[model samples]
Target chain A: MSSLDLRNLKINVGGKPIVKDFSLTVPKGEVHALMGPNGSGKSTLAKALAGHEDYEIVGGEAFLNGQNILEMETDEISRAGLFMAFQYPSEIPGVSIANFIRAALTARLAENEELDAAQYYRRLYEKMDLLKIDRKFTARSVNEGFSGGEKKRCEILQMAMLQPQIAIMDETDSGLDIDALRIVSEGVNTMRGPNLGILLITHYQRLLEYIVPDRVHVMWDGRIVRSGGKNLALELEEKGYDWVKEEVAAV
Target chain B: MPATIEKETSSESIAIDRDIGNFKYKEDYSYDAGTGLSEKTVEYISNVKNEEEWVRDFRLKALKIFESKPTPTHWASKDLENIDYSKIRYYLSKGQQPSRTWDEVPDDVKETFERLGIPEQERKFLAGVEAQFDSEAAYSNMKTKLAEEGVIFVGSTEGLKEHPEIFRKFFGKVIPTGDNKFSALNSAVFSGGSFIYVPPGVHVKQPLQAYFRINAENFGQFERTLIIADEGSEVTYMEGCTAPKFETTTLHSAVVELVAMKGARIQYITVQNWSENVFNLVTKRGMAMEDATIKWIDCNIGSRLTMKYPGVILKGRGARGEVLSIALANDGQHQDTGAKMIHAANDTTSNIIAKSISVGTGRSSYRGLVQMPKHLKNCKNNTECDALLINTNSRTDTYPAINVRGDGNSVQHEASVSKVSAEQIFYMQQRGLSEAQAMSLAVNGFVNDLIREFPMEYSVELKRLIDLQMEGSVG
Candidate 1:
């Protein structure tokens, strides 16, 4: 029911061009994995799409369900049904995870409408269960004193609760052990539905083994150089990103 | 719902409190004793109260001291000079009996508390609640079970006259009249504050609450509070203050003295929300004896100017003291608050945590002092004061004085002043929260560490107040 359309996007950090002439789209009912090595501008693109102020959007027009999102504020973009699961979520002290998610959900409500706390808690507990997280996790401050795996799982929990139209997951598999990796991947797989579009950015193909993407794109030097089916992920994993760079240079 | 659409806009009406002055009670004081302070005023107050000779003499002596002392000159709250001692009515009371039931209270008085939800809160959480209207307490209630446990809770007047054996010993010993100019004034004309005495070895689980309101214009609300927790007993007392806006400035000067006997624990909490035209000058201190603990949890918001420093003196082995404070200053307001910890005995410890938020051109200052004399050994103190400025011109200042004269005493003081970063706000906004909500969340997060020191109901009320205060805090 929703679609993310990015046409020739450019992003700069600290006045230096990082993501140059990038273009990609993950339509509803599909999962697209953008795989690249370190410093390949994958994270920058994700942050810019979420309207992070630090990532100066140089030239880009992102449309979410036919709505122009480039001119909108960060919160406006979020309310328009765009989401980003950060690689390193901030640890807000004294703000419990329950309150944080509740605020996020409440922000989407109309001014006169009130949030149903009972139904909210019911859904929150259900999400926690689906993500294999303890109900006690809601009591702790968001990401405060949490383990690496715990933080990543919290991101998934937020995604489940928000249920945005398009979700950009940045390195959701990084910093996660084998056990946490599978659980996070399972959450993504279960979340893959016709009403949701996902762009899972990762450095490794192991994440794709759990939630196989419909399309695999290998990015090098801030641009996607190769695109193929899920088989491309296996080929890229067998050969390093250096092989993709060589293949692109040969052209 | 509190925000009103006012067609008239004045430059001075720029603060966030553009609409909220619903707290007003009809005034029909039978004994208004006119304005101005004199020996006759002191005699009139004592006479009205039917006080004993010693109490009357105490008032007269305090009045002299108050007259002799000068207003503080070098304080950050420059508005202190604006108080007109000559025009302030020293005493105003209705001469009505305090009712144990709400129906017996005057309609206007009951409605004021009802609007403030005092009765509901008391029924929900507190074991006892007392209310001070203008100059005297008009209502008091206590759960019979708690009263049966020898927990004495009454107004200062009744406490002094009825329980002299308990109140006489520790009344003036903690904070003497000569402590400060405002305390001297309070000692002279003080009335209608909570007087709580917990018998030895009895623990009062539910907190005792006091609600103080200023309903009469040009009337000075001076309430002297004395709380004594006997040996091995524990009690927590909380108070809330609210005043309506007046064309002329109002004055609220209170003195609170707390004594924690051997192995006793006492915690005192204050939440003050005064109108914009009020000057709140207060003096509060506590004394902790052998193996006792005393804590002051104070929050100051919505006053034109506030100058208060809650202190504690650790006087016995293993005695402990702490002061956790939160201050918020909006436009046309000055919040100058801090804490003091004095170590007087071996193995005594204390801690002070103060957090302040300044908006627009408002100013918030932290002035802390911790001292350990030479004779005190194995004493420790930790003082941390953090300030958050919401605007470019908002001001914050920290002045911490730590003096350690003994070999085994250690003191630590940490202070920081920071602004809410645009990046943090953006991060929160990206999660669909508005800019104002993001800012409020960040500010509340800063003081979240210290607010945990409060009771459950109080912390919830504080959070709601913060959210309401943050509605227009950011431009």
Candidate 2:
């Protein structure tokens, strides 16, 4: 079984330490949620795990299936079965969404192995139908002039297509309306099964109601100070982050 | 006495004959202007071509104007100063009549054109083929069906000899010889360009193609072309050029005039990839009558210096003109190309879209003019010019002059200059394309809109040419 191990990771951005000594283990067949208040470094942890150039690994290691991911390039890290859905994906003009994703998938294939066009289109159309996206959307430029809901749905579509071993969703529920949120959660739920590990980063417990996680962790000031079952999300949501702050103060 | 002996022995003082053996196509025709321009030379060319006295007088007048007018000193580079008129051969044509079959063409000349893929295009889809070697059209033929339908496709000399009335009517109407010094030179010694006329109410679906090859050194090719599309007629014309590399420079000055009658449509496409030793100065213009349409699709790939501006005059109401131009300049090439539009009647419209790519110290300049008369109402013009520089040493410039006098006229002009960014290359590389492939794709995508306007075969050839230019582009 595949697993991603983050051992005492310390991440820094712009010379300020953000993710400090945070540790989490997501083995295959489990869905984990990291919930925290704003500026608690949840996004930083996700980005650092994804090997974004802006984040520096000052200390500690992140391993994908027992291999260090810190040594690989961003694209290499991606091809090595770790996928991070961006909080804000880049908008590439003049590049169609279908071509972009096809390029990514083509890159993942072995040399001298050509992608079967018929099979690719069949799977693409099926997934697009499931996501309720128009088939004509494949011809439009990548994320150019797309609405917020469209962009989120596009990201989810890519996630579904790539089918990474460890899917890191960084605030996937943000900017989505109620119906869109349900659709996105249902998409995530459909992909949740054996042979896949999920790390969902969110600011509210509302999303946890749909895709309930096996474990919920509370992050405060760049570190996870508490860990509990699914009810921890409900408790934190009911009492607010001030309770966590008061508990830390008591500590 | 000793000095005279030394002068005779030295290479500089002897009066060496400059008639570098005439091209194979010129075997049948007499060399009227052996090597230079004079009143006698103009007279010889006119008489040898059996031109009307009026045409001869026009040539004489143009030769006088050419002799008196000074060269352009203010234009880009002004490298025409080095052209020695006395050392250049003006007119050389094969003495044989235009051939109706490929078998009638001389084998050597036919092989050369075949190597350049001219005959294949004719055999496949072209409605007509005119292959000009040096100063003479070696082969000219049209489909029998087109001939039966009263389509006239022949050389300009033949047109002057056989259809003088129609020839004289529109000879210099669009672009007069006195328009520029090159045009004056072309008029004085012009030979061997295509003459096409479509009968009324007829539409030629397939393209007519002409291939011009310059195989001799220090030779000047001045071909005068005139095309007339009758009412409700449609036609498309494609032309290409290639020449072997030479040490000394060669001069190519051609004049093409087009007339489109009411409800007629004309499309002229040119792909010129001359060797780097040729100076290509061509004048091409078209006049559109009421409800007529004219389009110029020009792609410039190679030349030492090219100064061509295809123009269209909207003289009748509801006339339309369009120009789509693309230029790629490698090392030691300067492509100074653009389009001009003149609105003379009400409700006329024009659009000019041009894209250029420069690499390895090459320079590309866009010079355009759009004018609407004060009395013309509801005329509209949109001009967009973009340049992409592939290297730091390359350069691009845009010079657009717009004069809209009427209050109701609408005009828009936009220009942008951009370079291939390193980040774009890296981004594409991250997606698995090599650096060269990425550059090619980016350059292709940059001109995707204009390239799509070309025919399918031409689009494939253009992509191959762009890919060749992108080779060795990265460090």
Candidate 3:
């Protein structure tokens, strides 16, 4: 089993501190919901943990199963079992989905080793079927001309294929409808097990109703200020974020 | 000056597995017109070919025209100044008619093509094969099924000797000697290129292949190619070139003229991987009649300096033309290529898509000319050129001359120069692809829309070549 542990993390973007002194840990078998309002710096935290170069870690310690990832390059961190599903995935025109994943898998192989086309496609079709993705989608350019729902689905498809130990889905529910949310949530839920730890970042409590998380943490002004069980998400949904802001102001 | 092939790869990781572009040259010249271009050199070439008096006179007139014209000074590259005309041998060949059978072909010539995989390719995908050594074709063969259907695939000399009735009608008419300085010189010393004539209503199912090899240094390979697709006929011709590296430079100046009669279609594809020391200057143009179509799909990967613009004239109602090209310029190379489209009739259409990659200090440019006169009603044209720079010092330029006088016509031009973005690389790398594979995929994707027009085999090899070019550029 693997885990994603972040301790006293401080992150800056373009010389401006966005996330400060944030600490959270999602163990191997559980999903943690990080709920925050806009400008809460959730994305900056996710990007920094994924080793994005722009997300400067002024002070932080991140580990993928005790392997320091803050010191590694973005790609190296990925190979070290960290994945971030983008809120707005980039469109790669003319590169088919099949080929993109194949390249990634090929990259992970030892030098001079090759991917077996037959077994690879067999596994791909199986996963595509599980996600209800059309067989023809594999031939289309990655995320090019895809709808919002389709983009999220494709991201899930990639996560399924890459099989990362810890996946931070940044706004995976953002722009998706109720039906699409159910499908994408189902795709992620199927992958949640002892081998996969998911950090579901969302602005709304609506997603947690479908894919319930083991714990909920409220992020405000960069760091997590409150922590509770699954009921915290429902309380935020009823009380709205202003209640938390007022509480923090009083404190 | 011995001709050798220098395979350049800065990183062992790139070529260690792919091992492409490892071509070598072996010379066996039986009729060497030696170094220097003069009336005597022209006369010696004509005598060796045993040409008729009229053809000899045509060569003399073209040579005189070539002498009178000055080198083109307005283009992007000035490497022409380095070509020592007096030191370049005009013609060299293994003295014999091109045999139809591979067994009769000279051993050196056969072995050279064997390395290049010509005969094997013929067996796999081609319907015809013409392998030219320096100045003359050493082997020319066509599938008997195509020959039975009146598809004539032969060397230019044989085309002149046997089909004078057809050859004389369109030899220099489309691209005459006075068209340009290079065309004039090619007309004077041209030899060994393919002469394809598809008769009315006959469609060649498979593409005809021609391989041009330059095996000697300080030599110029001037090959003239002419293709005529008669009414309602269709044909595709693919030509490949591989030259040897030498201390001194070589010149490959070719003139290709194509004519598509009413309702016919012609597709000409070129894959030029000349050595870095070769100056590849060429003039290629085609005329499309009523309801006819002409397409030029060209890929240029090697050479010190290349300046070529394959053009098409849409001369009749409803005619269509297209030029799809990709150029890769490595260090010490400049690829100056583009397309030309002229609309002379109503309802004519044309499109041009050119993509280029510049590595290190290499430079790539697109120069295009599109014209539609006022009288041509409802003529339309579209041109696009995109360039990718691989390094900080890599260079790219665009010069498009568009004159759309036709009030009822429309013209559109689009061009972009971009470096492969670090963000794009990161996106790919996040998926676990190495830097080289990511860059290679980006380059391939840049031209993939046009590359899809190539045959599957060609596209695969083109992808490999691009991978080789992209290697070592990024860590």
Best by DockQ: 3
Model 2: how far residue B327 lies from native, Å:
3.8
The i-RMS of candidate 1 is 1.5
lDDT of 2 by residue, B237-321 (tens): 9888877666788899999999999989999999887777889989999999999999999998877988899999999899999
Candidate that would win on TM-score: 3
Q: Return the candidate ranking by lDDT, descending.
A: 3, 1, 2
Q: Ranking under DockQ, best-scoring first?
A: 3, 1, 2
Better of 1 and 2 by TM-score: 1
Question: Which candidate number has the best lDDT?
Answer: 3
Scanning candidate 2 chain A in windows of ten residues, the lowest lDDT window is A86-95
Give one digit per residue, the lDDT tens place, for model 1 in B101-220.
888887777877876789999989998999888999989889999889989999998898889988888888999998999998998888889899999999999999999999888989
What's the TM-score of each model vs. the native?
0.88, 0.76, 0.90
lDDT of 3 by residue, B174-252 (tens): 8988898889888888888989999999999899999998887898999999999999999999999987567788899
Error of 2 at B42 (Å): 6.9
Q: Give model 1 RMSD, 1 decimal.
A: 4.4
Q: State the C-alpha lDDT per candidate.
A: 0.87, 0.83, 0.89
Model 1 chain B poorest 10 in a row by lDDT: B1-10
Q: Under CAPRI classification, how is model 1 graded?
A: medium
RMSD of each: 4.4, 8.7, 3.5
